[model samples]
Target: MSAAEVSVRRRRGSFGRLFASEVHLVFGRRRNQVGLLVLFGLVTMLGVALKVSAMRHPGDRGGDLFSLVAGNGVFLGFAGLTIEIALFLPLAVSVLAGDAVAGEANLGTLRYLLVAPVGRGRLLVVKACALGVGALTGAVLVALAGVLVGVLLFGAGPLITLSGSQIGLGDGLLRLLLAALYVAVGLAALGMIGLFISTLTEQPIAATVATAMVSTLLWILDAVPQLDWLHPWLLVDRWSAFIDLLRDPVFTDRMVTGLWVDIAYGAVFLFAAWLRFRVKDITS
Candidate 1:
């Protein structure tokens, strides 16, 4: 074979190897498989429930169609969707993300990877990409599930906003997409938190629990009106402010602020993970 062809083949082989590694790192195991199944089940359940509700309420008017999902789900009276997402989405993030680095550390693979000459920063970046994709995909799935069930059950009609205003159904959907974007961004931060914790310990459960706890605690704190000073800084506080995405007279400004805040936190956690990973002694 010509040298040029051999070189091309070698490069292609290397790319394939890396791609395989990433896949193995993601879903080549039972836990991840179970996770995928569970997530899908949740989507189906929520979708069916929303569809049923729409069927039951058929002609109800002047309510937020977007509220049917928290990008995950919840059964609430006023804004149960927010409650449902608040509880479940974090759990999902915790489960998938908590194991990210810690799982490698526990299995003694992190040391193996570090010793192989791969840059720590690059590894972190790759892992972050995987987790980011997972989070975004999950968010979009839940949103789409809700929208699908909603549309199917209710038939085509004006989309009622949270503010009790009506909008063209298509425009309402665009707002939902915007909400999914911010919510996805926020959830990615949760993934980074899990990754950061993973770097600190080899116990995936501990790291995952810590990620969930931190999120829950912040949310609790944010709920207290007395903690006004810290509220704006709490990612927990504004988690559902993305609901503004579907409001009439549209509140894009606040949504943009929330997006930036989430993006900033995601960057910080990923940076911390990279730095800590470099110094981490993966050999247990």
Candidate 2:
């Protein structure tokens, strides 16, 4: 290969290695591991609780989509995702995204990393990719854990849709995976916001809390009936759109709108993060 070709290949190799290192650093931390465990544990508990409730009251189906869990184990994944998207998933994304840069700065290692050949923009890209992966991982873990526990306790089979129709086991699982991915996309948007926040502070904890609080605030605003006009603009407003995936015909309107909103938020914040980090003075 020519020198130009060789240089391009080397750059690609370096980027891949850097991305792998960042992913490893994110998941390798004890706190992140505990956070993932907590996510899994919560889903498992939800499954067990539903199983007990079903035994005590054969007619009770819990409530909402959760009610369907009594009939099919697959709904447990949906139920778990619903509960997680409300708060836990955002918090998990915040922890990773919020710490993406602040954590390195806090440890006095960011400067050392910057001293390498990688540009700041490339580093930020790697960090964003790692955060996205981490967010997706957490979402998938909850869905998988819910499915495993639900199947073990209740048993899996055809899923009953909200439209009062049924889908085969394979289709149901496919929808479940789609739902997990949808939720992850929303979480990834949240991560972008966290990434921007991380660029503003060296304290990872503060950035984490701030990023989480932003989600909490959006959720609170979304709950207000008078704010119906503003609901469409809120980031957390359409997070529950994943439920549409469980429908028989599979509603895509809300999911499509949600995807657009997520993309908008992600792109805006990601650009803002890049802009801020580009001029950010690394003191550590």
Candidate 3:
């Protein structure tokens, strides 16, 4: 290969290695491991409760099992998701995203990394990607645990959607996957917001706490009856839009709006992080 070809290959190899390293670091952290374990534990506990409900109230026509699980075994994943999206998963995402840049800066590694072959832009991209993967991994684990327990306890069968439509098991699973994907995408905006906050401070703990507080505040704001006008524009407003995926017709209106909302939040925060990191002094 020519010198140019060799250079291109080397650069690609390095970028790939960098990404892999970031992923490893993100997942290997004790906090991330604990976060994942907590999600699994929550799902498992919920599965047990659901199983008990199904047993004792087997004759009951209407209950949480029907509304949440939709009278299908696979819909149990949806039930787990319903409980998780409210707080559990968002907390996990915040942890990784908040620590992404600030952690490195706190450890006094950010300055050296910038001075090294890693460009500031590349570093930010890597951190953001790692944070995204961490968030998505949490979502996947919750879904997997929910399905495994649900299948063992409830048994897999036809999926009954919210609109009284019956779908095949395969289609149900597909919808569940889409729902999880949508959730991951939605939480990614939170990750971006945390990433921006991480850039603003050298203390990782401060960033993490700030992100969590912001998320809590958003949840509180979303709950206020008088805040109806702000609901559409709030970050957490469209998070539950994933529920539409479980519907028979697969309502795209809220899903599309949520996607765009997530994109807008991510784009704005990412730009802010980039702008701040571009000129900010890194003495630590």
Candidate 3 residue-wise lDDT, 93-165, digit = tens? 8788767888889999888778778778878888888878877887777778878878887788887677878
Q: Which 10 consecutive residues of model 3 have the lowest summed lDDT?
A: 63-72
Query: Could you estimate the TM-score for every candidate?
Result: 0.80, 0.98, 0.94
Per-residue CA lDDT of model 2 for 1-284, tens digit only, reads 89999999999999999999999999999999999999999999999888888898998654478778888888889999999898899999999977799988998999999999999999999999998999899999999998998898889999888888889999999999999999999999999999999999999999999999999999999999999999999988898998898787999999999999999999999999999999999999
- Where does candidate 1 stray beyond 4 Å? 1-20, 43-84, 163-165
Q: Rate the local accuracy (lDDT) of all candidates.
A: 0.68, 0.92, 0.83
Candidate 1 residue 280 C-alpha distance from true site, Å: 0.8
- Please list the residue runs of candidate 3 whose C-alpha ends up more than 4 Å from where it truly belongs after superposition: 1-7, 63-70
Please give, for residues 133-210, the per-residue lDDT of candidate 1 as tens digits: 777766666666555544454344555566767777667667667666677788888888788887898988898899
Taking every candidate in turn, the Cα RMSD to the unseen true structure, in Å, is 4.9, 1.0, 1.8
Q: Evaluate model 2: give its lDDT.
A: 0.92
Pairs of residues at least 3 apart in sequence or in different chains that clash in candidate 2: 61-67
Question: Which has the higher TM-score value, candidate number 1 or candidate number 2?
Answer: 2
